[model samples]
Target chain A: MTPALLDAPAEDRLAAAIGEMARRSSSAVAIVAQAGSAARCTIDYGWLSRAIVSLEAGIDAGRPVGIVARAARVETLVVIAAACGRQHVPVAFLAEDSRDLVGQLRDWVEVDDSLSLPAAAAGERGRREFETVPPQVIVATSGTSGPPKLVDHSWDSLLAAARLAEHWHGLGWLLAYDATRWAGIQVWVQALLTGGRLVVPASRDPDVVARALVEESVAILPATPTLLRRLLTSADRGLLCRSGLDRITLGGEAADAALLEEAQATFPQAKITQVYATTELGEVYRVADGRAGFPAAWLGKALPGCVRLAVRRDGELLVRLSRDTAEVGTGDLVQRRADRYEFTGRRSDVIVVGGAKVYPKRVEEIVRGVPGVAECRIYGLPSPVTGELVAGEIALADPLPENATPESVRAAVLAVCREHLEPHSVPRILDIVKQIATTPAGKTPRKPHS
Target chain B: MRPDVPNAIVTAIATVLRDTGRDTRPIESGMLLAGDLGLDSLDLAQTIVLLERSLGCDPFRSASTSRSVRTVADLIAIYDSAVAPGAS
Candidate 1:
């Protein structure tokens, strides 16, 4: 599909917004109240231009730029706008360790302490000029390998992704504003480009967020599965059902079929869709309904100019993007069934013992049925004799009403798995963890066990 | 006690922090939530959930206000003033 913004230059709207901010700083609250009763205060756009100008001043002073940033907030948006206007490469930070953040931003010349954008330059009617260049953002990504890596994307690439996303989704966004990570960058820019309101929260509370959705009449919300889970659990069934949301899109981590089913049950009116994309690759496929598996109906549709997907010779998934010609193969294994393919967990997450192949998610499905087990991660660990054996790391929902032993939990999990799985798929050893390994977004971390 | 501070606010916050794997020993009021207790954003969300169940006021009402709270004292101060006499 032809992205609406593609015909025109990418920076036109952003440039116009910067000009507007330059003219009106004091008249309105561009970034609203962060705390107290004034927590919802809205600062004018001029304040944002001023913040950019001030931050640009630091960059001019040979300072590495470090912005304590969030997304969807007026300040954060302004800062992002300002940085883009000033042609400064903004290094977006996550809600991770500050020390780690500092280390990651070591190359930055000036760091803005304000987590949100500073609203100093509000309204000055003048010609606001910007120097465009390749994207210099040190974006944090959940690389195919380890604890996310920082990748650089030119402004062109990001802007293209935004335009493409807006075109594909057709609905404007009510960004979770969780952070300026992958989800945030896509949602905010697309909304802004389309002149759609970027709904910012008063807080991260599920109840508060739920209220905001109703109050704002937010049509679309892109969120992690964990956040959606908490939102559904925070109140009665009618909470999200009556809210006039059109679509609730889930991404970042893998989707749990049970949770998707729960969402469908709760919000019968709203369409529930699952999206799978990475920072390295802008959204590849937006699966309409992956509750059963990857939706085939949505496949073969015109992808953004940036994405192309195909199964590799080794049965893994491979991607080729416009930005990069080299196909970056993913760890996920897919088995084609006619035109639609089924996700067989990650190739690395598979266990093979005694010439038998097993997937962790298959084992997890069985373990999830066991009573008192909150969550589980299954992977293969090295065993001298079997080469590798199935292992499970389980987190109990709540201590077994006070007297539950690890042995009891293990027995329950194994029994459930044995009842469902074949002899080869049953976990040989199970370790009880206090909590499942999750990324900051709360997706269960399912690295290969070995 | 300060006019804004509640009688059991400190105990409540400490209990919440303990659930997050913080040292419960002599749970002090001055302990910083992230700096000293290793609590992250997720833990803060959990703390809000706990306080709502135990106390009444939600210290994390919106994103704008919640980001400023770095320490337990900071959180307690906000929570105390929110639940001060005659305030909900």
Candidate 2:
């Protein structure tokens, strides 16, 4: 544990590793907590140490402490590190309802309890010093998105990822995303290792996130394709007029050409990186240029000791342990291109509309091309006439350009789909939204409208 | 198609819920899943296994169809449609 602190520079250590980051970095506001206007708060490490002490105390009790936190908060970082240090198995839950979340936890635990930072800090210091423990992380799976499946990870697994990430980029602003599930867990660990500042905006709104590139002096942004498209244009323009960000990384969902181009246009100064990781396998690939499609080239050779990637006969991605023999078959459908591979969609995401096979991305790509549409998600529904029908959920850019009604947007989307797809591939039910509800990582919820 | 097929599934699902000591009503096509029954994401996985074992139908393989089966009726419709040809 002492070497963990000695091995890293002060800037790269966790709040628990360094004695006074919260106090010394008073001017460098580390986190901004925002809900509405007045409820917003910002803090440096000075006040944060108190919160960490509370987390440390809870972990000392040998109780499994679970944290349900807002994204990009320093308190979130401290609690995680404290849980890790105190040997307390830390479980994080990010879902829609607290009540429902409690219900889900019922099977796992008999007693329900919550620890608030403000309350925990009320007591004075005790003799209990936090101890290092074996790490376990529980991440919810998409199949269980309505409720999440807990995936566990070890300290070695998480640290290996950090070392690999540090090998790629030295230090800069880490644009962290709360990709719906456990993906966000990596963001915190990466920041702790790199000793770089974490940048989040006043809101998850793409516009605010874009502006923050200039306002916060951002450098590295890791996100899903859904969010990359939204912030790219604004960040690019903001960068041109002022200081710019450096890197944009996409994962969680596949990014199409249009989406990648949009991100490049937004942050022209940033390098575009793609990630191939899952809850099962920490991080399989680090596509620095978003080229190479297969994990074999990216993970097998490049990060040889880190991960092993294989493609099954049906084009499904498989991961074998880099150091061991555990093999994991991923459900994502992929295509190999010369030296690189690309994600097609989820095996479970395919829909048979009418008699033809329809992929949600195929229709989603076409629908995204329509003017005035901000974001869209496509799924299949059982149709009496066609066996399955393409259905879509859409969010419009505010003040839907001149004459852009939901009908017109649907018409434009349909016309594009019709031109490129069979009639069966066209969406039959199109629901409009003020904004698409997305998980922190930037993935559209499987049942977006629901 | 026999009218009893859908009824049998509806009755079985209700019984499963009841066996868990959950007070449930007779199954209707319109009953919302998450809202009407406390069956959540975990419950759905549990229900799917239970339904497969009880109904003795081929394990539902299609994701597109799984996405469409939102309600008890939707599940019943899928099960009923599959049983129709065999029941004849």
Candidate 3:
């Protein structure tokens, strides 16, 4: 659907649409929570209706309620559907360990595992009268340095770029992102809006996720490049191929050309697309050509009346969403090639080494192309001679061969880095490790030196 | 103390520095990996991997052991303890 077609109903009418959907498909399976091949639970629309009725008492129109960030939980979805459908309360998904929630969520009531709603007031049956307020959802930005900022969006803004088709209904969508976040919420909204089945993995384990995909026969799989890379290197990669995924959408992180190429080669049967989206910007534009970045012509061009893109003098991407001429700085740094613009890294993540600016993501992308390097993280470290030095921690795809030694492997990786990177851009310090740490949002943790 | 543990650690540290195109100064027990030898976190990690390969065991397998390794002597001590009699 085009953005113009999605603007027919005001944001206030979104709750009414959800209520109508519940009335239409009461017996259809809405969610399937699974761990590996084990089905944890399945909730149909009838159960969802009962859940909404039970949760309605706690929701107030125009108020913001906090849903604790828990993946694959039936109650989490219940709070979302109830708060979004009945009262039109803006839901704020809060990470469990987040420290900023106290100040940001002053008026929000936290809904956790202990939340209890009275049993439908004894004899309540069917749909209750729902107050129609402006539909809103608050999602937190995944910033690495400072506190995560919350971005508010209406249902129209969230679903403006969704491609709603008849065949989308009843297809299974794998939920890999946190449902409260924008990426996770997009998957859930896409499935719920079309009466499709949402497949929620029980854990972040790639094997478990892969098995769940096969067991649920997930058709649509949306994930970050980091998570997808993990799945690709896992032993259960065959399971993902056998799951018969029809569509694979990579987002949340800049998808490099090497990763895009590898994914296309691995999932030959699925249509792979990379989405450039941010929590503050909503859906910007999607690249379906199996390339690293969008075409160069896309710069300074308006996309379908929904998004406009421009690069600043410093190469930071400025995006104008939904016909709004006021462009917002996305903080993403881009490099323009002859015909395309590739995202290099975030401007905030750049490290100044010996007066030369270096993007860790650029170095990481180059180093990742080296054979036997499964995952790696690049960061800046304090140096006495240079202002800061480029450093990297790499996890091997497999243990060193019986005939090979660690020095040989280290030398091989260094050789590749030297060939692709400039002398200063090459990592001065490189380590082979068992694993690289990732943030809660499934991104490489790039902690700057103090 | 294991007689070869110190030699193995020193050799690993030298190789890591040389591969990164840094000066391969002589390593000693008194030298601090970070302060004196200029080895960052990544270099230290590579040194540990090389040491494990040479010694046939990883002394820094446990967090406590890894955390205690600050100097060349400390790293050699970890390897010495790991290879000692009755050590797990």
Candidate 4:
């Protein structure tokens, strides 16, 4: 999301994969898109086959080209499939974030709903082989910790770890990640590869996403831990719990114990799978255990694609893609806790107060246990006394606790910290925020200065 | 001077002491934070931040930086002065 020359381009593997899966049934729905919670649309395999044929004819370029589009749009996939079908590699760019990249891209094509899908000729797409191959499609990293880096992938490489058994038929999957991005592409491809229907919410807003989930009965949800935590505190908390969410996929950031435990409790029936993968390392091993981090025994073990996991002395996990490729530092700090290696926090996110390192993840795990607390963010605040001081922002649970006030919750948070944590690790500055602030990528920023 | 400023300071000190399981007896303005109260430097740092949260300002962080406090009254006086109308 890789290698092939001659006829079929590297990028169209995803479309071909969809074309291949399109043979399962004539009326199989592949995509469910809800724009602005108003326009609900459904695209079947017959439509996809039509769009590919029509769009492929309009493309004349034989080299790589770029398209400025949003993944939420089905047209983005249509154009990408058409370009890939024509053997022209395509690079995707978000409309807003494409300003700085427009001049850099060799051949930029503007993709929107206005680019109509050519009408289907005569009959439905026939039962023929689409020849799914690794077509190199350019995608960018989430740029959570740093600047976004463009990476190349194909359907074969992108969906390498995708489960394609027939049992996945008609499963409703939520496109929680940007359909143009890595995690989002996985959900999109997985839904298409299997006979599942991919659900695209109007927006990432918790209320809208929750409504889409319950309405569509989305079974498979691939999301970041931050989004999961926010959804737990949403107004539709009760509905989401009872929804048909059987598979909860957590990725993007490190899944901490508190978030994992809460997500498990919220979706008790759903099987929680934490995927430890990066844009550079591609799809690595997955953890199904309801724990925070991967198993300790997985260390130095070679996973699929000949990738092995190791840790630096400073606690950063090093992922080596293959036998020959150099190790890629994940920047994720993992600590060994007995049998399992739990991700304490990011190496860059460590809060050092008075020379002692304080992991915000450890502090958040303690704060999240408080009865009234819904979510909490522990960050480092600049201090005249210490280099950095520990500060906490707490967001109370959705359903207010009985006989509980903000004053009582704050007091309980303080008492719990004093009882459990060390003096320095205890947050001196406590704020009961309505909600914990998150980055654009739906991650809690640990540095207050930022 | 506002009576609540010194009162809140004493209450904040007692809250910290009680939370830390330190003995809070014979406490007065004359009591030394380091010796009589057995408040370590780390505890003092925490006290300043807590006071900032409750009282809204850190005296040491504004107007003055080198000012040192030996007793509880000195710490109380620093905050009271900062909260004054003309105080920074």
Candidate 5:
């Protein structure tokens, strides 16, 4: 494939595209690679072509010989995050320290840093300003931090509960997450079963994933709400519209009404589905008709006597796998909103600043009330002193605060929080971000205190 | 032991006290955090956190730290020994 068009000035990009198409593929690759080769840059097309060919051979042999991933310092993270295509060998990402967890997989192979490119040049390659987060994404790390999770699952075990539909036939499904991941594996099987196309992007970068979706004429897209938000924020609106997306499945994280409304407006043609799944429970529940959570009526109702969904008094969603099984906790909290139950946050989503419980939702609401604040997200940062310190990611309203610094906006938010919240609930850290980092699973680990 | 540990501890306590709209006067070494200074457990946590950032160490990490620290001096002593050369 020719080098993907650069997110440069429209006219300059067009000229560069025309010139590259004239000069040939390698010239086009060199131009893109040369533009930014200082941080972590995307793998050049020349390298990707070799990797794809190797990928085909590896899958045919049914053995994973490492396909050198492109990112320098984050090569392992890239391979783990993008676990690009359907793998015959079931892959599970383990934390570097969890040596024991590796035993859970009998034939698992570690995709190490023996990457295709040298560490020196790979790291030096350019990462853009828009790509705020490094390639070391949170989703790749201990999926929702606790005891390092080990999901000992195979294609058959995961597909045991899948409800197949004839409508899945011939639709192009975008592999928007780690293919080894539960959601990714499910998408792959659905595509395989339906004789449909699974468009696996070479990179998790929104630009690359969005381009693949559009260029491949992908009809079905499965992604986390965070990934969908990133795609909407990063991709050109016109380019996104070019894709014939008939279905958008959001899972792996909670989907809010605002995000649902935004996605609905962006792709009115596509039907949105909010699905919730866990490593323990394959695909727990699904909600359609453009709502945040499943219908309250679905609560306490058993799904074919296989998986029954219920909520705790404190709001955690509980699922009973079968008639004989005890209710298993999903760690997600849900709230009844008129006709439906909307997932509020995870049970552990609270920020306990010192000894007091500081709800992120409460803090986010107060932060959003500040004069210039248009949007805000609340999360905790690890601190030895307090159990965890409260942090806020704030996006400003239009007509920018005349040369506003993060410091200035933070000071204003601090003033408001102090009045409404307890002494311990005030956010210690605040960032004025253009777009909060949510591209790759927005759940940044609230690292346990030492 | 570092000479500035007592002074640093006092400063951190004062900072947390200021944020909570409490009196920021006469932060003596013998002043009990909860009793005399009116600093709650969370306020004490804030003080320890601030001290860790400024002093570049957390004594609680190496040595067993009691939740109920009686006075400012006890808190200072814990950190002072932590930063001492050859200290754990």
Candidate 6:
């Protein structure tokens, strides 16, 4: 891995990196969007520069600008480059359907395919004027449980985890996450910083995404575990193996050992890595040992004076970003095993049954191990007698066997849960549901169970 | 009334369950499709499609009637009512 670009005290590394790449190879493909077998659109560094110059002329300096548009669009990226890179204006990327747009964004622009550069401003360009203070890049939280909040990051902080690969080229990245989000931004940043191509899918469909991966010859794929599971199950597994994927980075949700092992088995060529990160805190650390969590030795260890880890008495993982004493709570509950700290579940996702606390992820893991269960969601239901009763909604795998009945599957699931989990953790009410609802952010909804 | 409608629905569900490596023995009319059978949205959809193909009619197309189906008995009732005498 190349060293991180932290030695240089630059204001906007994004702009500086793009400027350098434009000078090096203007014809290099900067962005690619694939629909089916062929690329629908491909933008080079030269075209990107012209667009950025034109866009920069219109925006005012030293102001936060919100870009309200679909993340997959090329124009959205252009706006981000112009606002955050050239004009030194902070850019907040908001989804088109975002309802909470009025607050925090007094100056915002809505972009679409119809956006075009003015003929007069197309020729006016020099190097981007680096501001003394780097503009912040704002990303919204996934809002799985509640309304999304905007988080700000400087260019240095945003590219903290990105490996510096100045000489690397032709690296294709599949845009699996929402481009407006931190994970999505990281994908493009890493690609752009290294002069690689960013592959955008025509749609969020699993087949389309898989096709893009194969057609674009994508090397790095960063995605949430939920999306990865859906892709693995819905798309052709053989096709994925042939896609030449070198690395698979999973984040956003807890990466269980089962999923990690399954990913490893499916893509033997790729190095599967699980990243512990949050929207609030950037990437904390990454585990690539083909295991579920980081080694227990990593506890209290500091990484190059930039980050330090500590487990609180209550089991919440606290990360100190800098050498200073300031720390942030990850809101995740972890348990220290003999050799490693395993992520159990989110603190807020714990369901209390009677006086006993049960983590839904633990129950879900146990329930999913049952033979016939394809997918499941564990939650707490209101009960006057027990305060909250453990409940589960399960989806059976397709083409269930002739001998298998609903009761038999339920019994099997309950039996496994009883064996693996505590008595209180076993779901008291197990329902076979057609589907478990997911938030718009593609996260399983942990809303208070009605 | 189609005398074999209930049998056909049961047979369709049982075949689907059996093919998918699930137990089909507990598929009684009184059992809840979701709670008792562990039929998720996808399984339920596949089951309905199979039922429609076997019964030669789409009960779910009638929103007013299909909305009431919560259990195996309710599914059988819809099929019985749809294929019964004087039924539209």
Docking level for model 3? incorrect
lDDT of 4 by residue, B1-88 (tens): 4447777788788867765556777569999998889887666777887787778888777645567789999988888887788766
Question: Per-prediction count of colliding residue pairs?
Answer: 47, 21, 0, 6, 8, 26
Please give the TM-score of chain B in predicted model 2.
0.64
Which candidate wins on lDDT?
Answer: 4
Local accuracy of candidate 6 as per-residue lDDT tens digits, A297-357: 8777777447788889999988997876588888998998789888888998888866889
Quote the positional error of residue A308 for candidate 4 in Å. 3.3
Please list the residue runs of candidate 5 whose C-alpha ends up more than 4 Å from where it truly belongs after superposition.
A1-143, A147-150, A160-166, A232-244, A302-307, A321-326, A348-358, A361-403, A415-424, A429-442, A448-450, B1-39, B60-81
What local lDDT score does residue A110 receive in model 3, on the 0 to 100 scale? 50
Interface RMSD of each: 17.6, 16.2, 7.8, 2.7, 3.0, 13.0
Local accuracy of candidate 2 as per-residue lDDT tens digits, A1-450: 245664653223454543345444534444544422235465554555565666656554534444434333545644555443433444444433322444444323211123343334222333335545543544555442445444455545555655434444334444445522455556655653444445545577655665565555666777888776655432345444464666777788878878876666655677888877776666666666644354435534425456667678887877776556676888888877666677778877778754677778867878888888878888776544355556778877655789778777766776677678875676655667666666545676555244
For model 3, residues B3-66, the per-residue Cα lDDT tens digits are 4987888899998788876788888899888899998765665665566668877665554563
For model 3 chain A, where is the 10-residue window of minimal lDDT? A117-126
Question: Could you give candidate 5's per-residue lDDT for residues A27-146 as a string of tens digits?
Answer: 222111111112323333234334434443443344342222323222233233233223322344444334465555443344445533222222222323452321221113344555
Let me know the DockQ for model 2. Answer: 0.02
Pairwise DockQ winner, candidates 1 and 4: 4
Give the C-alpha miss distance for residue A153 in model 3, angstroms: 3.1
Off by over 4 Å in 2: A1-15, A20-28, A35-41, A54-77, A87-135, A138-146, A163-176, A179-181, A233-243, A291-303, A306-308, A323-326, A336-340, A397-406, B1-88
Displacement of residue A312 (Cα, Å) in model 6 is: 2.9
lDDT of each: 0.58, 0.58, 0.71, 0.72, 0.59, 0.70
Q: What CAPRI-style quality would you assign to candidate 1?
A: incorrect
Q: Residue A156 in candidate 4 has what lDDT?
A: 58
> What tens-digit string does per-residue lDDT give for candidate 3 at A1-450?
224434445433333434456688777778887646555778776666566655665544223443333333644554455445445555666443454754766544555553443233232222337645565666676555576777666667777766577677668899888766667767877776666788888888878888888888888899988888888876466676687888899887898888888888777888998888776566778889998878999876778656888899999998987564688999899989889999988887787777889899988887777667788889876553455667788888775556666666677778888787766777766777777776667777777422
Give me the candidate number with maximum DockQ: 4
Residue A327, candidate 3: alpha-carbon lDDT: 84
